[model samples]
Target: MTTAHDYAHQNQERFQQQLIDLCRIPSVSTDPERKGETLQAAEWVAADMRKIGLNNVQIMPTPLHPVVYGEWLGAGPNAKTVLVYGHYDVQPAVTSDGWDQDPFEPTVKDGVLYCRGSSDDKGQMFAQLKAFEALLANGKPTVNVKFLIEGEEEIGSPNLGKFVAAHRELLMADVCVISDGSVIALDRPSIGYSTRGLMYLEMEVFGAKQDLHSGAFGGIVHNPAQALAEIIAQLHNPDGSVAVPGFYDHVVALSAAEREELAKSAWTDAEWKEATGVPAFWGEKEYLLHERIGARPTLEINGFVSGFYGAGSKTVLPGKALAKISCRLVANQNADQIFGLVRDHILRLAPPTVRVEVRQLASAGPALMDLNSPYMAAASRAYEKGWGQKPVYERGGGTLPILADFQRELNQIPIMLMGFGLQTDGAHGPNEHFVLEMFKRGIDTAICFFDEVGQIK
Candidate 1:
């Protein structure tokens, strides 16, 4: 009898091809033009799930896009069921964003495959399906399996919460395993114990109904552009800390031991500058580079649109200005509280000449897994068994709303964040790619994890 590991290796070529096929679809959730492509991706997922022997596969509809749900509950009553979570949606990408090849076309160079959704999740999610196929084909799986792959993750997973809430009995499981992020290094497989929360908001400032001539009304009236700039400037202090009155009141400070552990991450200022092309390093003066990003909360202006930014000189003071801001919250901090504080601050800083409006776009609380649980230990052993390397425990700066929901609603079930992609994969950025080696490792790890968890009660 062939082992699942051996079966996974034997089918590596086919797995790679299927992943490329999935990545070929431009399932960009935010693009209205790609709605059909998104739905096509969903149907493709359902078909593939059925081909892998999974039953009850369905293309569930949502307000915006569809979610692909499937399961295989052949395990005995004493066995555990693991809910696998991943997203088929991808961030918008184009050639102009600095890609040497077609963003949607899968291109292989050396040992990696490049495409828009290659790493940000299509490939990673594909690995999950292939892993199960290998396990079920090689031998009987000890634990039941279910997949909740969605198409709206890039757009903040707007409708998944309602779906999961309304289908509690249908989606019930003992745990959820997600492979949506990246590891600090390929050699170092990390399991995320915590993730930052998000609070996205939109700010609009209106000066006058119509455009005004800057030459004529330059000094007389306040420019909404200038007003917006001034207001945002007050958001941060000289020391690079959020200046909101209650922003840091509930921030969870990292313990010294925890800080020391995170400092062990494979991050260097040179690598950061080389990747981001930033001239210098800057952040909260008190915290280390890793601490500021990994554990500490942050306030950032994602986008800003004001007066004329066209090609030539147009001396027109636009009637309105708009800005999009986002905040990443840590432990003990609530999104509602942060949104309220930031919105109130923006409104109070506005001048009488401009009318300001703050809209709370979306929000989700942070998640921290209990690393001491039996399931995490099982995950650790699975990694060691699969990759021959001990896994590192880490906290991710990104937010996974579904992880928070699974943790909040399914409080008793454990959630594991065993990401298999590498940091250089460029997940949501230009030239995103996936390492074929990591893809194999992800499948092996998933196989072993199922076997390990099945031993538990």
Candidate 2:
């Protein structure tokens, strides 16, 4: 077998240049004005897949952006087929958003590539394609490989589930490998075993038809902003625990062995503080940070908007207040069921002086891979060979809804989570970057992973 060290060293410069080219296109999926740019990015990815020797490359159309599909099944019918999944779309970025430079133009300095999609997915996905090219160019691949890169992940992948359901036969595989997560630490390699599900909601509280001067309506009318604040405060109690009744009734508790494993990978308080740049960390007093984020369910208010304050203070009671709320649910917690509980809680706690309305924005079920599967064992060996260290098992606080959908539509193929970005890469934040070293290592690791999966019985 070819070693990752030698393959990476041989093609570092070429891979770096290709990534820069891919990052140059502004493929933000949320903006309607960037529709053409989104298509351009999709085409670029499809062209690259063909260049990498992937056969039957095609740009499958969806209601939104296109889905890029390709496959190289030359390893014979007996060989295990591995499906690789990733996204080419990225979050919107602008200069006013604290960006150091133009977001679309990739910049490399001090071994870090800075851009909007560098770490979120484009860079990571590109690395896998490059790895395939390197392995094919060297001689021949031992495993059948398929690529299913999409262009609408940043927008909650609203159409991916439908696409997967419609083309089940085309996407059949022994197992699916996702290269979209981040490394635990820059120096240590980790594997994600599960992801929490998500329930996103928007709440609006209405007081009156229009804004009124505080002096004119002081103490006479209800303030929507105050009412919104009260509703939010009621979601939690003094112990920093969610007060939603029966919220924990359906949640599955982690096993004793799972708890021990989480404890082993648990970050120290100091490290947590440093990573978040906060003076201190706080959460449910009984659970540790890792447990609160990974194993436990959470309710978070992501965004809130109400009255206006520009330059000078305006004493006007806004007519309505809006809030964007999301919950990260653990295993056995259904998104729709949790959403109903949240809505009911808000209605019961809301003051009669104002009317509150809850709107469901999006939702996805949680995903967990069977760790005992042979595919996981192959991946463990692959990471060990690539990183020179045993890969640590971990779970992410985020959600990938389509993963669960894939399981329902296709056969129950064990999903593998593997990627080469770091947590500090600033995926959704300003000046997002992907480490050059990690990018190259990720390519090597992917190549090694293919070889290992091929050996699976």
Candidate 3:
């Protein structure tokens, strides 16, 4: 049998070309204009699965964008089925967003592939496909594999729950693997053991019926913008902890062992500050930066829009002010419950002069994977083989909502997160790129995972 290393050496160019082809689709699910592109990307993913000899490839339509599902159950009835989950959709990008080049046009610079979806999901998702190709070409695949790539993940995956619920039998698997996040720093293969939940909301404060001259109405009326600022300020206390009542009631405290493990990961506060270019860093007071980001819950004002001052200062009191807020929830916390508490707190804190209304934008439950599961052990060994280093177990500050949904719908099957990307890759921002070295390593890691999974029994 041809070894995985030999297959990788021979197919390196083909793997890179596939990622370039996937990046050129412009699959931005949030924009209406790119709806066609979203479906086209799904088609592209399906076609790649077919090219890899995966049977039963189908584009399952959703209310929004479609999901690409394919499976190769030819490993026989006793073989364990592994469901691979990833998204083909990408966050919207444009030249006005400060891209060094066209976001959809893939470019190779300094051994990095720069594009909109280069590192987020498209690049990671393509890695799994190439892994399958290598396994098939080498005649070494030992377990059943299924692919479930969706195009609406960037939009909160609003319809995925229903779809998964509808097709439980088809998606039933011993384990689910995801490769959608950054690895633990460069040269460290990481496994995401948990992800914080998300509750995104928009708060709007209303003052007058229309804009009024600041000189005339500044003292006479309560400015909605001012009220909005005050309300946001009151969300946290002087100590920098969120002030919402019952907000942390359900947050499970981290264990001492977990804290020690996190501390050993070589994350320095000075390094974080330098990376963010921030003068200083502050969080919930006592925790380290890694803990603050990964284990602790946080509330952030994602965006705020109030008054207008385009070129010059316009002395006008805006009639309305809006703010987009999101909370990263820790383990055991519920999204709806936390959102309710925050909304009530804002309403109670609002002055009688202005009316405030809160709208829930999106929400997803927190997910904690069992680190002791067989699949995680298999993934660890796979990464060790591929990267020549033992994998580090870690958690993410951001949420992948469908992860929780997959567990709930699939009878609590353990999900394994084994990805190849780095924080410096710039996933959601400008100059987003994926390291070619990591990309090749990811393919090798995935191919190794299949062999390791087969050995588990």
Candidate 4:
């Protein structure tokens, strides 16, 4: 009798083509103009779910984008149920963003599929779908499976919390598996147990009500742009730590044993320099680079804008300046409290010459999974059997808003992050791509994970 792995191997070509088709739709959730395309993507997922023998497939609408949900429950209720989560929406991309090809047009070159959403995370999500297809084609899977692919992950999943809250019984499961991130490398597989939270904010400094000529009001009026820059300069101290008081009050310090384990995955300075091309590293000098990224909190200026210079110099000191800031919070930190502290600090730093306003755009609390759960052990065995390596435990530097909700609403079910792609895949940037090998292995790993979970109970 042919096995699920054999079925997956036989359907590799078709799976690759299916992924290409899905990635072709530019489902950019953040762009209002691409609403139709985003809906198309959701419809596509629902259609495929029906094709793959999943039951109750639907395009559930939300305040923003819709969520595509499906499930297979051939196994009796006595068996374990695995909840799979991923996002179909992608970051906005264009050829001018430094891509050699159209971001929506999936391109295959040297075994890498280049396209937006391939790795983050349509490719990974589809792997779960295909794995179930293979399993059902071969025989009945011992464990039941459900899919919860959403369209708003790119925008912080603002409506997902409400959706999950309203559908607790529908989404309740034995465990949750998320395949939205990257492994340490192609050869070094890893499982993520903790993810950092995010707090995004926008700050605007106002002055002079209208544009003023630099020659007319040279030193008399304080330029909002200059004042904004001055305030930003004071946010960080000389030692590269945030100057915001109370920022560290709620942060949890890493234990000595945990620090030792994190060090195993720390990027060497040479590797960091090779990947980033930075002249040198900057941050708290005491912590290692990995600790600074995965364990410590961070404040970053995502973007800044002010008076414009079209072609030549406009010679104007614009009325206002705007800056986009984001903070990555660690465990035990609250996003709302941190936002208040940062906002108050910025306001205090503002000079009387300009009016400064700070507003929060988004926030997600940090989440830590139970590493000792049997589901995590199943993930480890799956990686070993499917990818021929024992996976290492790592703390992810990125944020996934749904994990916190799953923990809160779903009775704190164990969440396993079975990342398939590599970090160098350039997700959310120019030349984004997913390796064909990773896609195939991801399918195999998902199948193994289900089988391993089946052994439980």
Tens digit of per-residue lDDT, candidate 1, span 1-457: 1388899999899999999888999999999999999999999999999998999999999899998999999997679999999999999999999999999999989999999999889888888888899988977899999999999999988898888887788788998899988766777888888889999999999997888998888887788888999999999999999999999898777777777667776478787788789778878988877678778899999999988888999999889999999999888789999999999999899999999999999898987776668899999898888866888878888887787777766654678988889878998899999998999998998888988889887
lDDT of 4 at 353: 95
Task: Work out the TM-score per prediction.
Answer: 0.83, 0.84, 0.85, 0.83
Worst 10 residues of 3 by lDDT: 1-10
Badly placed stretches (over 4 Å) of model 3 are 24-40, 90-116, 204-233, 277-279, 302-323, 350-355, 426-432
What's the ranking of the predictions by TM-score, best on top? 3, 2, 4, 1
Q: What are the per-model numbers of colliding residue pairs? A: 0, 0, 0, 0
**Deviation of model 3 at 337, angstroms:** 0.9
**Residue 224, model 1: Cα distance from true site in angstroms:** 5.8
Comparing 3 and 4 by TM-score, which wins?
3
Clash count, candidate 1 = 0
Over 4 Å off, model 1: 20-37, 89-109, 114-116, 202-233, 273-281, 302-324, 347-356, 426-432
Writing each residue's lDDT as its tens digit, candidate 3 over 1-457 gives 2386788868898889889988999999999999988888988988888988999999998888998999998788788888999999999999789998999999998889999999998889888888888888777478899899988888878899999999999999999999988787667778888899999999999999999999987898999999999999999988789999999899888888778766767568788977899888877778878888888898999999988969978898899999999999988899999999999999999999999999998888898877678888999998998766898888788788888899889998899888788878888899889998889888888888887887778
- Cα lDDT of all candidates, in order? 0.88, 0.87, 0.88, 0.92
Give the top-scoring candidate (lDDT): 4
Instruction: List the pairs of residues colliding in candidate 3.
Output: none
